[model samples]
Target: MTIFRLPTAPRSLQKDQPIKFILDSEAIDCLAHNIALVHPVFDVQAFRQLALTDIAALGFMDRSAHIAAALKATLPAKFADATEVLINTLTPPNAHTERLGLGVFFYLPHTRFVAEYGRDHKHNAGEDPFDAAMRAQYELTRRFTAEFSIRPFLMHDFERTLKQLMQWLDDPDPHVRRLCSEGTRSRLPWGARIPQLIKDPTPTLPILDALKSDPSLYVRRSVANHVGDIAKDHPELAFDLCDRWLSHADKELKWVIRHAVRHPARQGNATAIALRKAAGGR
Candidate 1:
């Protein structure tokens, strides 16, 4: 068993505080080993050859981009074929776990690769590329969270992707339920901004409404973050949601309302103030 140590951040880039674990050489090696286990034909040498140069100089996004490009070089030339091969090679998600780690962490780069490949490729005559990407993300999320990878599909096909997210609100897996809210967040951290969602978050209201009291704290936290993201750009809409959900709020629902209003409350927004007051200023 090989143990991989996370590389230290370079002094010059320490202030930005890059997440060192996700893009380190160890992460690449872990991914290579796992890919080799699942796909005997995987070109481990070729992948490392393309991935390790000047890796220490790159930030998180740059590292992800390099790994993704490396995957394109080493995997099948045909995008669909490569995606299917990866899907088949994926380790199953642990139904009992909550946090992502271990082999799961290694899979994140592959998930990003598949999502990017789907975005860049053309589907067969009757197939929808967005649907294929969504399916790949769904499978990947079982092993590791797909919160970041789902953004591109949401950006390219808002209505269709949103409809699928709405359906995911009731998914059996907490991870999927979390994705429903997290992926749609207007200002998801480390994710590309969705201008349409920032401008008007009305479409996401139904999903939030359904998830505010979700049994999974993991899912509910995402709902709070989703509403909080909306609050940044559309405070009125965020307030409206707080007003509606607060009227008959339970403990869990109250938590969501409080979290959603936190940014606004700090900024002296009237509705946020009222919601805080209604919660006995807790």
Candidate 2:
């Protein structure tokens, strides 16, 4: 196999210019190299053939989707089988980051591939495949945030998925805790909207409650964003939660409450305004 040298940076289209596409050839080269390292059986030639063809015409996300589709074609026939192969062969999170500044970029396509696979086959008889996809995503989160990938499961099986997310609140990994909140957001950017959450965020309150004073700033930030997302559709709920947390809140929890109410406060919500004022406009 001929080794493709990873470009140090994206090739500029002109002097002192940056490439518009995030998923450019440099990214693809890094991805192909890492995948080949992990899964020796991965069809590098086929993957490159599909990924590099019509390359200039595609944008960032389109390039990602194209690579995922190509992966489905080159990997196992069944989605479950292909997912299993990927799960067993994924490179460690730190390894990819050490080599490529955008380590998570390599896994984004895989995450999308699994999510697409689940969406297409979610209505299948047993829940086994969806369960497998969830487990794969959990592992993926250790390497890269799988916040977007987990949404399909939430949409497909809300009850079971929420139950699992609740359990993840106590996980040792802060990334897992963050995913619990981020994945369930009402309006996660670049992600599918959860209308049910937008209507009533009651189901997600328990998870947020557990994470309010989380040790990890990363988890706390997600909790804040999750609350902010709720505020957009349910200001009352957001304020109520903020009030509850703020009553005897520590500094960390206060930070979260402040962030959660920011959007509502900007929108001139009286309760949000009061809450912000009470927090000294922090």
Top TM-score prediction, candidate number: 1
lDDT per residue as tens, model 2, 1-282: 434333354323445533425566676666667666657878888888888888788765667688888777777666677777777656554332223344355578779887877655532333457667778788888777788888877888889889988878898887788899999998999899987888888999999999989988888999999999888877778888889888898878888888888887888878888898776674
Single out the weakest 10-residue window by summed lDDT for candidate 2: 94-103
Window of ten residues with lowest summed lDDT in model 1? 2-11
TM-score against truth, every candidate: 0.86, 0.85
Extract clashing residue pairs from model 2: none
